[model samples]
Structure formats: C-alpha cells, structure tokens
Target: MLTGNGGHLQHLCAQCTSCDEHAPSLPPESIVQMPEQNTPSGRSSQICSDRRQCIHGISRQTNWVVRSSSLPQRHHIYKISNHFDPIFKLEAPDQISTDGGTNLASEEMEAFFRRWLVKVHLSSAQYPESNGRAEAAVKSAKGLLQENTSKGGALESDKMAWRQHASHGDQRVASCVTGYLQLKEWTNTSGIDRGYGKNNVKILHVRREGVVHSIKEYEINTQLTLNNDKDYIFGDNSDIIATDSQKNTVYILAKKHGIVSPEDFALLLCTHFLSKYPYVEKAKIDVDAYPWRRIVSEGKAHNHAFLFSPEIQHTCTVSQRRGGSAAINGLTGMRVLKTTQSAFVNFVDDEFRSLPDMKDRIFSTIITASWQYNTVDGVDFGKIWANVYKLVIDKFAGNPDTGIFSPSVQNTIYLLQKAALDEIPEISKISVTMPNKHYYTVDLSKFPEVGSLENNEVFLPMDKPAGNITAVLGRATKSKL
Candidate 1:
C-alpha cells in the first residue's frame, strides 16, 4: 500500500508491468478517496496515470520495490526483493509532515539509514555511485512528483510542498571504508636468512623438502593511523599503495627464505613494514600455523600422503614499534585424559550438593596453554614446544613411578605447570585452563537382582554444567587455580 501526500491511499500491485495496460482495469473500490481539503483539482484520468507509472517504474528495477505505509506521524518503507524474500523496512519520521509539527531527531534519522543499509545488504558496496539501479529509481520518483505539481488543482499547495520536500537532500554525510588481503602458497628457497636454507637445499633430508606448506594469512589496516592526515582525508592514497606492497613482501620473503615457526614468520612481516614505510611507525602481525602429519600405514610413514591434525595449532603475535622493541607470545592446545586416577571431594554442604563423594573417577580436560618467551634469541621454539607439551601430558596422566591418584583437578594442573617451568627455563610465565568433564555412574535401582550397586561399572557421560579451573604459574610467584 502506497500513501500519497494528501492522505490518499492506493493498492499498488507488484505484478503490474505497464500503466496503460493495468491502471484503467483496477477496481474503483481499491482506491481510497482523499479528504475534501486535500483532494487534487486535476482530472481523474491524469491522477490514475501518474500513480500507476510510479508503481510500475519501481517494480521494473532489480526485481525489488519499497512501499510506504502510514502510521500516525511516522512512515515506514517496506522493501521486498522477490516473492520468496523477507520484507525489509525502515522508518522515516522526518520524511513525513503533520499538523502537529513533529519531526524525527537527527540521530534517529542517521540510525534508521544505517539499519536500512544493513537490512538490504547494501553496506558492502565499494562504490556507492556505481549502483545504477538505485540512481534510476530516485530519478523516476522525482519526475513523478514534479508531474503531479504541474496539474493545477485543490491539492496544488500540498503537491508543491511534497515536491520541495522530496527535492531536498539528506543533511548527513557517510563514508564506507574497507581493508582486504590475499593468500598464496610458495615453495623453493634460494638464499639464507638465519642459517637454515644452506647450499644443500637442492636435495634435503625429505624429497618434498623446504616447507611442508608455505602458506600465510595476512591483513593490513592503516585507516586509524591515516585518518587524521590531510592528504588521506582529502582522498590522497599514497598510504594505500604502501599497504598493498606488504602483501607482495610476504610471498617474496617466504620464497627467498624457508618458512620457520609462526613467531619467526610474524616477526619478519612486522619488521618489513617498520623498516620500509617511514610513515608506518608501528605494525602488528598475527599468524597461525596448521600442522600436517605424515600418514602411517603398514608400519611405515608415507612419503607424500599427509593428514591434517587438530591436536595442536601454533599461534604467534608480534608487535613491532618504531624504537626497535618487540613482544612475542607462543600458544597451543593440548587434550589429555586419565580414566582411573582423578577425584573431587571435600566441599561445604549446601542445598545444591546433590553430587556424591568419590575417590576415583574419570578426569578429562582440553587444556589451552600460552607461554611468553623472555627473549627469542638462541631459542629453538619447535623443540621447546614439543618438550613442554610432552611434559604437561606426562604430568597429567602420571608415570609408573608417580601413579595417578589426583585429589583434585587443581592439584593436577599445578603440577603440570611446575613441570613445564622446571624443564623449560626460556619461558617466563605459563597459564593453563582445564574444564572438568563429568562421567556419572548409571543408576540401576529399578532392576530386581543386579548384585551390589556400589560395584557397578556402567556410566553416563555429561557435557554441560562442568567445573572450570584456571591458573597462572611462574618461577618466582604462584597464583590461584
């Protein structure tokens, strides 16, 4: 339903293709007559022609049309793309004029337009003027209003007022900015950077040598740093050229020098931006390395066949400053479980204490551990990570000498932390979080003869309402778990 300036209502059919073919055939009862003071003095034929043309022109563009519905002083534009699509609507109170002299606030109008763009999925347009369909629709709507004003009638004043209202442009200004990146795989190393890829790079230990998969994900955003520069604010884009060059540098460096750990890869990326671009004082790079393990079949590892492993994911963050200072963090995930040596007991009695005491129960936890390196110099990150991870698992599952008799999850995690810090001295601090997965004993009270229930072995595993235990451990200080 489309409402005109004089409170006249018309049912605009979306299937109508042409005004001459559909306007005269519409039933008389479908159109609502305007009030005496607001009715136009033009002939009935001209009014019907203008109304049908406005509706027909909108439906022909992009297979979508938006119609306004009257609601007191507020007006809403509901847009539909197709018969199967949902209706997208936006309120325009300032677009309507009433006798009470009420209008929408400036903030309200801006928010309404923002929400409209998101609803119609038009906010991602790289160039707004490139949308020719929307431009054509605006032009058609404006021409329809101007034609109505030319017809002298009782609605001449109202028509002229609406023409002026539609002619005015929005007072607010908006800008849409975007940042993009690309990814590619590179192989074959030539030169050496830190004494890894040497002259024997032609035939190394593995035939599929160099990097298992030398692929990196990168993104560069300089909007915040350049927002205040006069050259950038006024549309000078020399800074954007610098950002695009960073993408090329990632491939060039990876092809020249072999791929190492994520920390090293991220550090190389950050160093390039700070050294090459004088305007870019600081740069942050984040990298994650996915592990691919060789498949073992018939007691031997395959040469080219590999399987993706989610057991451990390597992540690193490097922040480079203009003063030549950097910070790096190494993180990974480890899943460990013990079936017969974990317990939870000794808590204050309360109404929610429906759980029974147990001395032995299955304990399972997925641990996420992060360690900050004191210094990257002379440090073998791959070796240290493998050793530290093995130590953590060994402490959780226990060995033949120690046995598995954990009093609580907290105690087990503390021991795991202490073991990692004791063997790996390069790490300054370590943090671990363990979520307690419950495995409850199945109840068989309804059964007639099932021997003693205390000795029952059946159990039911639960995934929710689990306990969460976290701790941060260091060589010199201790924290709560």
Candidate 2:
C-alpha cells in the first residue's frame, strides 16, 4: 500500500494482502511472503502477488507517491491503466499560479515532449528489453509511416501534398537522366569551332552540309546536384523534369551549335546546366561519340554516306561545379604499325622465359590515346587533338631524327609522349596504351621443293599470349601523370 498526505491510500501495491473498502481492491491469495532472512533491516520489500504478472522474473513493484500538499491546485494527474500504456503522464506548466505569481509557460512543455520522445525512441532501439511497449510502438509507427509515404499507396496523395507545401515539408533528392542522340544534323562550316577536321580526310566529309548524316551518335549522361532542404523529393513529382529537359537540350544544342569535337560539345553542356539551373550546384556531363567513317568511292570520300565504325570511339567526361574549374578528359583510338622498327630484349629470364629475344621485329599496336587539357576556356581542342593524333602516328612510325630502328615498346611510347607534349603546350599529360598484336613468321623447313623462307614474307597472326605495353608522360614538374 502506498500512502499520501494525511494517511490517504494513494495506490494499492500488488503484494498487499487486503485493502480497505475505500481503497483499490486486491486479491489476498496472490500475495507471496519473502523469507525472513532476506528482508532488509529498515526497509520493506514486496514481491509481485501474481506469479504470471512478473516482468523478467523480477517481483518488486516500485511505487511513486506525490503528496497532495506538494502539488498546486491547478496541477493535473493521469493514471496509466496497464503496462502497455505510457509510464509517465506529462503536464504543461501553467503561466500563472493560483496566487497570481509567475510560473513556467507552455513552451517548456513542448520542449519537454520533444526531448522525451527522442529519449524514448533512442532507448527503445538501444535497450528493447527495458521498454518492450516503446519498442513495439516504434516499429509500428515506422511501418505506418512507410505505408503512408510509399508510391501509389492510399496515403501517396497526402504525402505528395505535404512535400509540395511550402510551410509543411521539404524536398531534396538527387536524380540522373541518361539519353542518346540517334541522329542530329551538324554543319561544320558554321564557324562556331572550325578546327574539328584539320589535315584529316575524315573532316572532308563533315565540311559540307548534310554530307555526313550520322557522323557520330552522342550518348549524354548528366547528373545535377539538386538543392533540397530535407532531401526528400516525391517519387511522382517533377524532380526528373530537369533530367528529361537535358535530353532534349542535347539535340537542340547539337542542331544549333553544330557538333565539333566531343570535348567542345561537353563543355557547352556543362556551361548550359550551370547557367540555366539556379538550384543545380554542380553538373557532371559524360559524352561518348561513336565514330562514323565515310565509305570511299573509287578512292574518294563519298558525300551523304557513312558507315558506323564501332572499333573506335571518342569520349569526353566533364565535371563542372558552380564557381569552380571544369575537369575535362578526352580519349580517342589510333592504330599504328611499323614492320621493322620495334624490338623486345633484355627482359628478365626465368622458368617462364620461352620467348626468344629479338633485336628487330614487326610492331603493330592499336593505340588508345587519352590526354587532358590544362583549361577548357579559350582552348582550340579540335586543333590540339588533331596535332596530338598526328604527332602520335608520326612518332610511332619513326621520323627522320629517330629513324625506324630497333627499340623496346616502352622506349617508343615514351618518345611518342615527349614529341606530342613538345608540340602541344595546352596538353598537360598524355597516356598511351598499346597492345602487342603479334604476327609470327612461318617456317618452310619441312618442304624441300618450296625453298627456305629466309626473308620471312609469309606469317601467321597470333592473337593470344601477346605482350601489353602502357605508359603515361607529362612535364618534369607534373607528377600526377
């Protein structure tokens, strides 16, 4: 039994054997008396009257008693009926006391509730055994919230309405839209960026209008960093409108600005998104331009005709942040061959050294050259790329200064980079990957009448077990390459 002021019965303890008629009723037979040796000297401890009602096998029933004189006249009291209910009742402090003196306000009550809810939720997750009801309630609440917020659900309309409301909710979510331009007309003579085709026969077909119907199929992938307060965007909202608009913008820009090199076009795209969208903080634009070469007619480049060449492609990936420098990377395919200049020798000889050292051997490689520009502004990417391509081919084929002589692929790639960097000052670094396409000379020793194959004119092209060589070159101070 718990007693209040003036000896009033406030609560009937579960272990109480009997209660007065005025007090709450209790079952007398449920009371269990503890062993006398276990009792404390000054304090009284009671066990749960009903064995089935015990929690975690602990029988003690803790009681809290508030004296009537301690509470104000206006103070409210709430009783919890069962263990499933909230353990404590909350009361908002009154602004004025009964004596007309200043008291705590209702704002404190709101703060108290917020802190209490956070503590309850955190404790329920961290220590579920301490408050099973709180844990169960938290799980139920989460499931209910998800059910109300899921797309196409019954509460979807309300959730969306709340997200759109200015004072009610917030929207912040990231989205990416990828699109491909199947066919877009690009007139090269528009004078926007005229150095797209310099000293290359491929440019001859793109110089005239409608001559190259589908010169390059551009695949554009743009990601916009959106600004939302709570980072919650409705699933069915117009958050993807910007992405869809970017797809259309690609075609429109291609038709209007004319497709130059992939780097130039990618720069235009980065500029468009950063300038157009006020909410977009950064834009990442990646473009892959598929190559298309014109079918030659009697050794002449055909007009209004083209063939898709999937063997090679030009790629440009540009990342533009608001008020930041743009990072641009460009890559293209180039194949070069020199029948008697390349060699492989002086390598480590181990148990796996089955390959014989050769001072002079045929070199053929499909080169994929990638380079980075120092800056995108005011740079003639088309001209620089053309010069770089020519320099790579010339160096691979050997020049007058470095004639076609015996050397390793490593030496050849280094010289290739050195020559390109010497001519193109705008290029900060260049990376070249050359895979060795081996062509083995055939032997005719068994055939006596066929004569000896001394010159080794006849050969068999070996696809597997070929050597791979790669290297990157930059200025003396540039170590990142």
Q: Using lDDT as the measure, which candidate wins?
A: 2
Off by over 4 Å in 1: 1-207, 210-248, 323-333, 400-402, 449-452, 475-481
* lDDT per residue (tens digit) for residues 208-260 in model 1: 35444223332222211221132322333444334445555666766666466
Q: What's the true lDDT of residue 393 in model 1?
A: 67
lDDT on C-alpha atoms for all candidate structures: 0.46, 0.49
Per-candidate clashes, comma-separated: 2, 2
lDDT of 2 by residue, 307-394 (tens): 8876556776777777764645555565556777778888999998988998778888788777777777788876776677667667
- TM agreement with the true structure for every prediction: 0.50, 0.53
Clash list (residue pairs), candidate 2:
172-231, 172-232
* Per-residue lDDT of 218 in model 1: 28
Q: Residue 426 lDDT in model 1?
A: 85
Q: Residue 82 CA error for candidate 2 (Å)?
A: 19
